[model samples]
Target chain A: MIVAEQKPFAEIAGFVADCNKILVAGCLGCVAVCLAGGEKETEILAAALRMHRRLQGKPLETVTYTATRQCDPEYVDAMADLVKDVDAVVSLACGVGVQYIAERYPDKWVVPALNTRFAGGSVAQGVWEERCGLCGECILHKTGGICPIIRCSKSLLNGPCGGSQYGKCEISKDVPCAWQLIYDRMKALGRLEWLLEYQPPKDWSKSRDGGPRKAVREDATI
Target chain B: MNLTTESRLEKLLKRGEFVVTAEIGPPQHASAHEIVHHARLLKGYVDATNITDCQTAVVRLSSFAAAVHILREGLEPIMQMTCRDRNRIAMQSDLLGAYSLGIRNLLCLTGDHQSFGNHPTAKNVHDLDSIQLINMVKRMRDDRVFACGEPIKEHEPRFFIGAAANPFADPFEFRVVRLEKKINAGAQFIQTQCIFDLERFSRFMEMVVERGLHERAYILAGLTPIKSIGAARYMQKNVPGMIVPEELVQRLRKAKDDGKNVADEGVDICVEFINKVRKIKGVAGVHIMAIAWEEIVPTIVQKAGLYPRPKAD
Candidate 1:
C-alpha cells in the first residue's frame, strides 16, 4: 500500500494564504488504512487550518470530504461540484489523488497536503515499513518471499551486500538485514540452494528505467 | 575511445603508486573561506581530496560547488554524489554540470538517511541506489547515453568513478563480494569506511585479494583518528556502520586518565595505522578522513611519510 503523511499545518495554511474558503479532500484507500489522509485526519486538519488562520487574523471557512478512493475517476468525479466552489483544495491523498483532483478540476487550485512516502505495509501500530520496491519485476518467489529490493540498502540482485551484520543493515541498527531474513527463511524451508543460484544484475528496464509505467489489461479495458 | 582522458587519481592508480587522499567537509554556511583554506591545505599532499556531499546527511554547500572551488585552488577534487537527495533526473544533470565545470572524479554513495540529518521530516528521494548510480554513470561515460538510453550529443561526463566500502559494516563475508560488484559496476577505486578494527579489516582485505578484486580496482584503506576518549566513546556507541575496536577506545581512555594530550595519541595511532595498512596486500592507498580535525592531516601525512605526492602527467 502507498503510505503518506500530512504536510505541516503552517505549510497547508500558506498554500491558500490569500483565500478564505478551503476544501480538505481525503482518500479512504491505502491512506485511510495508514491513518494519514483518512476522514478523521481530514477533519482534524481542516479544524487546525481554521484555527491557524484565525490566529493569523484571517478567519477561513473549510469543507471536509473523504472520497471512497481518490485514485478512481468515478470517486474523484463525485467531488467535482464541491471542488468548483472552493477557492483552493488541500488534497489529503497520495500524489496520485492530488493530481487526479487537479486534472478533474483544472480551474481550482489543488495542493497536496500529504507527502507520499514509500509503498509498504504496517510493521506495527503507527509504524509502516516499506515493503515492495515497486520495481516492475518481482523476485520474491526465489528469495524466500522477502523483497530485497526495498529492504537491502544496496539492493543487490544477489544476496545481501557486506553490511549485513547480526541480521541488521549497515545503514542503521533499526533496519533488519533483508538478506539475513532471506537466508534464515530459506534455511527453515531447506532451500539454501537459491543462494547458490546466482541472480544476475537486475534488468532495470522492467522497473522505472523507462518513463512512467502503465498496465492496460485487454479484459479490463473498454 | 573511453570517452575521456585520465584524471590525476586515475593516472596515479594506473602507475601502481601508493596514493594518499584526504577529505574536505564543506561548512554548512556559505562563507567560502573555510573551504578555500581546506583546499589549500590538501592541495599538494594527496592524489585527490574528496568533498563530501552533505556528509552525515546534514545539509551543506554543494559538493559540486566546493569541487569547482577546489579546482580553482589548483587541486583535484573527487565530487561525491549521494542517492539520498536526488532522483535520476537530478543526478544526471548534476553530473553533467559538474563535469562542465571541470570536475573529473566522482564518488557515488547511498547517503546517510534523512532522519539522521537536521531535516528529519524531509522526504527522501532515493531515485537510484549507489550501485545503480555507478552503472548509470558508467553508461553515460562509455555508452554515451543516460540511464534511460537517451544519447548525449556532446560532452558526455567521463569520470573516474569511486565508491565507498565499509568492511566494518556487517555480514563480514559479503563485504568482498559487494566490493566486487562495485568494481563490476565501474568503480575504478574504493575508499572504505573508517578503520579502527585492523584484524577485521585485514580479513575483509584478504577476501578482496582472494577474488583478485584489488588488482581490478584500487582499494584505499580508510583512517579516522580518535581525538579524545569522549570522541572515541561517541563513535563506538553512536556512529552507525562504523566499528571502533574496544581496545582503541580503552587506549584513548587510558591516555585521558594519565592527563596526557589524547589528541596526540590519536594521531600517533592513526600514523601507525597508515604505516601498517600501506603494507597490506592489494591495499593501494589510504584515505584519511580526519573530519573537523583537518589541521592534523599534514602532520599525519608527514609522519606516515606520504607527503610530496608524485606529479601526475
Candidate 2:
C-alpha cells in the first residue's frame, strides 16, 4: 500500500489559500486503507478547511470527491467532471495519486493534502510499521523474508556486522539486529551455510539511481 | 444548576443502576444552535451528554461552547478534551475556563494524531498524554494549585474526570492494569471505546472487579448502533480499536431480510445490547454514541426503559 501521512493543517491551508473554489479529492486505495486519504478523511479535511476559511473570512467554496483509486488512470477519469469546475484540487491521496491528478488535468492545479510516508502495515491496531523499501530488488527468500534494506541500519547484504551486539543494532537498543534475525532464521531452517555464501554488492543502476524507471509489455498492451 | 452534576452522577453510581449517556457533536458549520437543539432533545433522557472536541481528527465547534450550551439547556455535559492542538498552557487555561463557566464533568483523551486529522500539516502539541492530564486535573483539585505552583484562594473546580480504554486494541491482560493506572491518576469514570463483544467486556469486567477497581471507578460501555451493513463495515475497517461482532452483522442481515426499518432495527439492537449490559455484574453504565443522529437518543432511552425519572438533585 502507498502509505501517506497528512501534512499539518496550516501547511495544507497555505497550499490552497489562493483558491476560492476547492475540490478536496480523496483516494480510496492505499491511503484509504491506511486511514489517510479516504471518504471519511475527505469529509474531515473539507470540514476543517471550511472552518479555517470561515474563521479567516475567506468564505471558500469547498466540495469533496473520492475516487476508487486515484493512482490509476481509469479511476482518475471518474473525477473529470468534478475537477473541471474547481480552481484547484487538494488531493488526499498518496504522492502517486497527487501526481496522477496533476497529470490527468494539466489545466487545473493539483496540491497534495498528504505527505506520502512509506509502504507499511499496521503493527498494532493504530500503529503502522515500515516494511519494504521498494529498492527494486527482492532478497526475502535468501534473508528469511525480512527486508534488510528497510529493517537493517546499514542494509548489509553479507552477514552480521561487527557492531551487532546481543542481537541488537549498534545504532539503537530498541532496534533488533536485522542480520542477526536473518542468521537465526537461516539456522532454524538448517541453512546456516547460506550465510557463508558470497553475495556481490547490489546493482545501484537498477534502483532509484536510474532516472524515472518504466515497465511495459508489448504483448499485454491493448 | 437545579440538578447538581456531581450529585446526579453520585446518585447513579450509588444506585448501581444502568446509567445512560449520549454524545453531542457540535456542528462544523454553525455553533450554539445545533448544540442547543441536541441538548434539548436529549435532556432528562440521558444521564449525561458528551460534548466531543473535534472528534476523528476533524475540527468542529468548540466543546467548551457546546458544554456551556448543554448546561444552559439543563443537562450535564461530559466535556471531552484532547491533548492535541493545545499545549499544556492552553489546556490548563481551557480547563480553568470550563470550570469558571460552570462545566464540571471531563473526559480526558490523547486525541487523534495530527496525521489522522483533516489538516495533515497541523503541528500537534502532545505536551501531555491522557494519563498525565488526568493526574494534572487531580492535582488541581486536591492541592488547589496548578502544576506550575500558582495558588488561588478559591477552591478548584470539582470535575468528575473520565478516560477511555479499548480492550480490543490492547492485550486483554493489560486492559485492567491500564484501567488501574487511570484510576490511580484520579479517573472517577471511564467511557470505553465501541464494544461489539459483550463477552469480552464481561471478561474485562471480571478482571476489573478482581483488581478491586470496581469499588473506585464507574465504567461506562460505549454503544453505537449500526445503521446499515455499509456502516458496520466502515466502523470495523476505519475506527481504530472498534470491533463489531458477528452477531451484530447477523442481526443487521436479519433486519435487512425481514424488511423492517433498518434504522429502527439499529435502535432495537442498541436496546438489546443495553439490556444485556445492564444485567452484567460490575457494569456501571452505558454511553450511547448516536453520531449525527442525536434526535433518536430519546427514543432509544425510552425503548431501553430509562425514561421518566425524577430530576437528579
Candidate 3:
C-alpha cells in the first residue's frame, strides 16, 4: 500500500489559513489502509484546523469526506459538489490523490495534507516500512523476493554494499541492509547462484525517468 | 593495454605501483581558492586527487566545476559523482562535461543520504545507484553509445572508473563479493572506507585475494588521520559504516594524556596503517582522505614514503 504521513499541523494549518470554509478530503484505498490519509486522519486534521483557527479568533468551517479512492477520476468527481461549496480542498491522500482532485476541479484550491512516502507494508502495529520503489521493472523473482529498489539504500542490483553489518545498513541501526536480507534468504533456499548472474543496468525508461507513464490493456479497453 | 590507460591514475595502478589519491572537498561557499590551495598541497605528494561531489550530501560547488579548477592548476583530478543529487540524464551529461574539462579519473558513489547532512528536507534524485552507474559508464566508453543505445561520435570520455567499499560494514563476508561485482560492473580501482580495524580489514582482503580480484582491479586502502581523540571517539560511536577499534581510541587517549599532539599521533597511526596495509596481499595503494586538514596530506604521504609520485610520460 502507499504509505504516507500527515504534514505538521502547523504546515497543514497554514495551507488553509486564509480560507474560512474548506473540505478536508480523504481516500479509502491505499492511504486508508496505511492509516495516513484515511477517514480518521481526515477528521483529526479537520478538528486540528478548526482549533488552530479558533485560537486565532477566526474559526474555520470544515466538511470532512472520504472517497473510495482519490486516484480515480470517478471517485474524485464524487467530491465535486463538496469541493465547489468550500473555499479550498485539503486532500488527505497520497500525491496522486491531491493531483487528481486538482485535475477534476481545475479552479478549486487543492492542497496536500500528507506527504506520500512509498509503496510499503505494515511491519508492526502503527509502523510501516517501504518495500517497493515502483520501478516499472520488477526483479523480485530473482532477488529472493527482496526488492533492492526500495529496501537497499543505494538500490544496488548486486549489493549489500560493504555497509551491511549484522544484516543492517551502514546508514543507521534502524535500517536493515536489503542485500543482506536477500543474501541470507537466498542462501537459505540454496539459490545463492541467482546473485552471481550479474544483473545489468536497470532500464530506467520504464521508470519515472521516462516521464509520466501509463498502462493500458487492449483487451480490457472496453 | 587497457584503453583507459589515458588517465594517469589508471596508468599508475596498471603498472602495479602503489598509487596515492586524496580527496578535495569543494568549499560550501562559492570560492575555488581553497580548492586550488589543497590541490597545490597535494600535487606532488599524491598520484591524483579526487574532487568530491558534495561529500556527505551537503550542498557545495558542483564537483564537475571543482575538477576544472583542480585541472587548471595542472593536477590530474579523480572526479567524483554521487547518485543522490542527479538523475541519469544529468549524470551522463555531467560525465561528458567533466571529461571535456580534462578530468579523467572517475569515482562513482551512491552518495551519503541527505539526512546525514544539512538540507535534510531536500528531495534526492538517486536515479542510478553506484553499481549501475559503473555499468553505465562502461557502456558509454566501450560501446561508444549512450545508455539508450544512441551513438556518440564526438569526444567520448575515456575514464578510469573507481568505486568505494567499506570492509567494516556489516555482512562482512559479502563485502568482497560486492567489491567483485563493482569490478565486474567496470570499476578499475577501489578506495575503501577508512580502516581502523586492521584484523577485520585483513580478513576482507584475504577474501579478495582468494578470488584473485586484486589481479583485476587496483585496491587502494582508505586512510583518514584522526584530527583528535574526540573525533576518533565520535567516529567510533557515531559515524555510519565506520569502526574505530577500542585500541586506537585508547592509544589516542594515552597520547593526549601524555601531552603529545593528537594530530601528530593521528599521522603516526596513518603511517603505521599504510605500512601494514601495504604489505597485505592484493592491497595496491592508500587513499588519504585528510578531509578538512588537507594541509597534513603532503606530510602524511611523505611520511608514508609515497612522495614523488611516479610521473606518466
TM-score of each: 0.75, 0.59, 0.89
Candidate 2's residue-wise lDDT over A1-222, tens digit each?
Answer: 777888999999998898898999998888998888899999999999999999999988888999998879998998898898998999999988989999999988999999999988987776787888787878898888888767765455544433344567645567787776886787789886665454443554566655678889999999
Q: What stretches of model 1 exceed 4 Å from their correct place?
A: A1-130, A133-136, A141-144, A152-165, A170-172, A183-216, A220-222, B1-4, B152-154
DockQ of each: 0.22, 0.02, 0.49
Instruction: Estimate how well candidate 2 is docked, as a DockQ score.
Output: 0.02
Candidate 1, residues B89-207, lDDT tens digits: the string is: 89999999999999999999878767667887887766676777888898899999987888987879999999989897655655676677778888889999999999989998889
A200-222 per-residue lDDT for model 3 (tens digits): 76888898877999999999988
Worst 10 residues of 1 chain A by lDDT: A193-202
In order, what are the TM-scores of chain A for the candidates?
A: 0.97, 0.94, 0.97
> Candidate 1 local accuracy as lDDT?
0.86
- Cα-lDDT of candidate 2: 0.79
Candidates by DockQ, descending order: 3, 1, 2
List clash counts for every candidate, in order: 2, 8, 3
Q: Residue B189: error of model 1 in Å?
A: 1.1
Q: In model 3, what lDDT does residue A57 have?
A: 100
**TM-score of chain A, model number 1:** 0.97
